[model samples]
Target chain A: MENHERSIRLPDNGNKVKAMQQKLLGVAVIAIIFVAWFIAARIISKPLVLPDFVETMQQFFKGWVDSRTMSNLGITLKRVLTGSAYAVLVGTVIGLLMGYSTKVMMAVSPIVNSIRQIPIMAWVPLSIIWFGLGEGPTVFLIFMSAVFPLIINTVSGVTGIDPNYINAARSMGAGTVAIYRDVIIPGTLPSFLTGLRLAVGSGWMSVICAEFIATSKGFGFLMIEAQERMQTSKLYALMIMSAIVGFVIDQLIRLLEKRLTSWRFKNGKAVG
Target chain B: MARLSVDGVTKVFEEKGKEPHVVLENLRFDIEEGQFISLLGPSGCGKTTLLTMMGGFQAPTSGKILLDGVPVEGPSSERGYVFQNYALFPWMTVEKNVAYGMKFSSMSAKEKQEKLKRLIEIAHLQGHEKKYPIQLSGGMQQRAAVARALAGQPKVLLLDEPLGAVDFQMRELMQNELEHMVREAKITVVMVTHDVSESVFLSDRVIVLSSNKGRVVADVPIDLPRPRDRSSEEFDKYVFKLTNLVRRAFQERTDTTF
Candidate 1:
């Protein structure tokens, strides 16, 4: 090891270059997917079933994404954010209660588990009946989609804390409130973050489902309308837009996780 | 004067369908105002359990622990307990961790800062205050734990195997550093350990406990002078004596049980 020359091939100062290479790798994969899409579209030669990549991109840029599509996307985003936020808040609180108290777990677990076993998709008709069609049912479906994962994850996080933190906090003269505030919450953060990520994914999924049933506008509505009207290019464009939105939101979440949990990675990923 | 007294403390754990397990039976000791005492034993000898009881994190089933003639009801800043794992909050920086105990203290802002600074220096953690515990080495974390423990100006320091998690090479240095800090603070220290040399080296008195009922089999005092030489015959003699006593205790417990 000592015999090796310092300047020959270390690349020790090439971290930026390494990062650029990683970005290029992601771009390359996307480019390959696009190439495959173009080939399939060309081979099919039918504009109704599998629209050509060029026509879809053209429709996305000029024809399809006008004020109406933009407004629909905005509406979907709003419902996703509002409903998921409520789910996260409620789920975390309930989870903390159940996690901290065995009695709460005993009472809540059966009901929560039983409800969670039913497919989130199966809740759409019931939610419409219960809340009536419109934003109410849409938001309710999205909340249900997000809440279970949040509750389960938060419960695990709260219960999974190392007992030493509690003991140490108590010994440090911390009262009950201080212990929970300073120790329990921070100690359970990594778990909560994991749960939040799951909530976002499921919440987005619910938003799409609710849009299919309740709304006259939104990405899901556009997909159904384009299919009925035989506007395959617009349909493909909306599908692409949905994929992009979901991918962007998940990436945003990952970015948030990296920023907030930087300390965990400062070492070798030490977690609570 | 006795700073901490273990008054015939006994602890028993009862299971629903199983027999009661007596962890410690009639355990008694009086730790002086500035003495450094070590409860040395084998694994699961209830040494850590005894330390927990002294910390007031757990209550003894029968007997009581008193500090300055007052019965200890719960954990307080007056008694600093260092866990075996150090138990430093990984989320906080070293400075934040050392300042943690002081937050609950009744000290004024300036006083707390002064104490925090003093303890950081005592723990030899001057530059590493901004770094998180997870980023630190085991030995440094132990030092940070000591600084945090001393932050609230506790009259007594209770350590649960202070050097147990440290590297072999760093263990001796940490022991010496811990001893120096404890002496400078003039605080009575009660430590639990399963190491022979560790007990003999860092403690003023080593209390060896037998396993079966967690009884104190021997209380050996090493009257060796300060800066005691580890290579000296006197030090070796004390180590040998304690080691043999522990071995005999092990033998006796097994013999009695059989």
Candidate 2:
């Protein structure tokens, strides 16, 4: 009974207040971190190590569009989104294969294990050699890094479906294809979203690494150029913006996760 | 009328290098049309296995089952199975869960909608159409499972511990409600349950199984009226006889402490 109470959906006004407070809390934390950085940079650190936060902000707003920061940011976002799309599509197919067929799993397991053993960084030099230093290598790295989580998570999701649902669907005269299409796919979505969460982070990491190593554009490229030119303020600006981009992406994914999995949180505990 | 005949059914499990274990040995039973038959036994007596075989999820090692003179093949909409845990699609609302069977149904969309509405009402879940099974109470989940199972208007409904997860008072109420639903649908039911009072209260006939080799020990008939009183003398008599039968079966098995 107490659990039933705890599981009650927040009223409209209550929800508004909660959302507002959560946003405020998030901003306040970031502001405090900025203040601490301002004091530290002002007092102890060299300008090269940590630039003035206020100066970085002023330069960031002034030359934001001039330095191609926004454009580079757009390019990086595009690369990550496209690579993730391909990763999810291909990864879902591979996961379904591994999940449904033992023969496919046996044949693919060794190759997947071998690839996973190689570091994501190791793929940088190899990709540049194979595809040349352009979007090819950058996209390839992101795809490779993003796909492992997608494949592994999708496999777990598909294979982990409750047998009872399958049986129930089958008993209802649903054919094999229909069962997989309707029951298996939707039932496995929560688990797949968890994979998407991990994939986005890894995919972002790969794009940045590729940009820093070989690419002449995107956020990583901007940061590298700033470092080489001793533009500490620009580097700080890039760093702050980069963190914000990752944070916003993560927050969006989290909101999606919560939405897709409202079935789980409808009650205080996951009765299903 | 739906007549189900289970004839000389045997199920044996063969493990690697171990002696084969026979779960059921030439078990035979008959369930008449519209009868509520409860397969009652102590734990591990293969009552659930028997129920699953009836549902065509599992096949017998020997012999066959016939439904209205047709040999039972693979799973079909003609027979509905309700698991103890409800087996509801967690991602779906109660309305969708109840409406799921229509995807395979030959009925028109209008007909399906009417049936969905009626079943939801019969399950007493009028306001809960938007709620997921996880959000419901245990008894409510069982009702939703019943609603889903009855959506297709199957010849029979197989329930494996339909009320097992519900609280005690709720269990009694749900059992009565379930019997009412079954009667209203006029569907044959083969239910597996261990609760003696549950077996007595809900079934038109209760078939008790002994543990050693899954075999029916006794088949008791209840000619009691609708809404049979649990505190009544006749109900207590049935409970008493079944309790002793279960105890005797348990005593025969030296491994069991019950």
Give the candidate number with the greatest TM-score. 1
Question: What lDDT would each prediction earn against the true structure?
Answer: 0.85, 0.86
* Per-residue alpha-carbon lDDT of candidate 1 for residues B140-197, written as tens digits (9 for 90 to 100): 8888998888888888999998888777898888888888888888888999988898
Q: Write the per-residue lDDT of candidate 2 for residues A1-272, one digit (tens) a residue.
A: 56665656547458879999999999999899989999999897688988888899986775556647788888999999988998999888898889878899999989997887789999888889999987888888889988999889988998898888999998898998988887888877888888898998899988998999878999899889999999999888877777778888988998888877788775433323
How well does each candidate superpose onto the true structure, as a TM-score? 0.93, 0.93
Which residue pairs overlap in candidate 1's backbone? none
Among the numbered candidates, top DockQ falls to: 2
Model 1 stretches astray by more than 4 angstroms:
A1-26, A63-65, A267-272
Segments in model 2 whose C-alpha atoms lie over 4 Å from true places: A1-32, A62-67, A267-272, B255-258
| DockQ, candidate no. 1 | 0.55
Candidate 2 structure quality by residue, lDDT tens digits, B127-240 = 888888877878778888988998877888999998888888788888888987888898889999999999899889999888867778889998788788999999999999
Model 1 lDDT on a 0 to 1 scale: 0.85
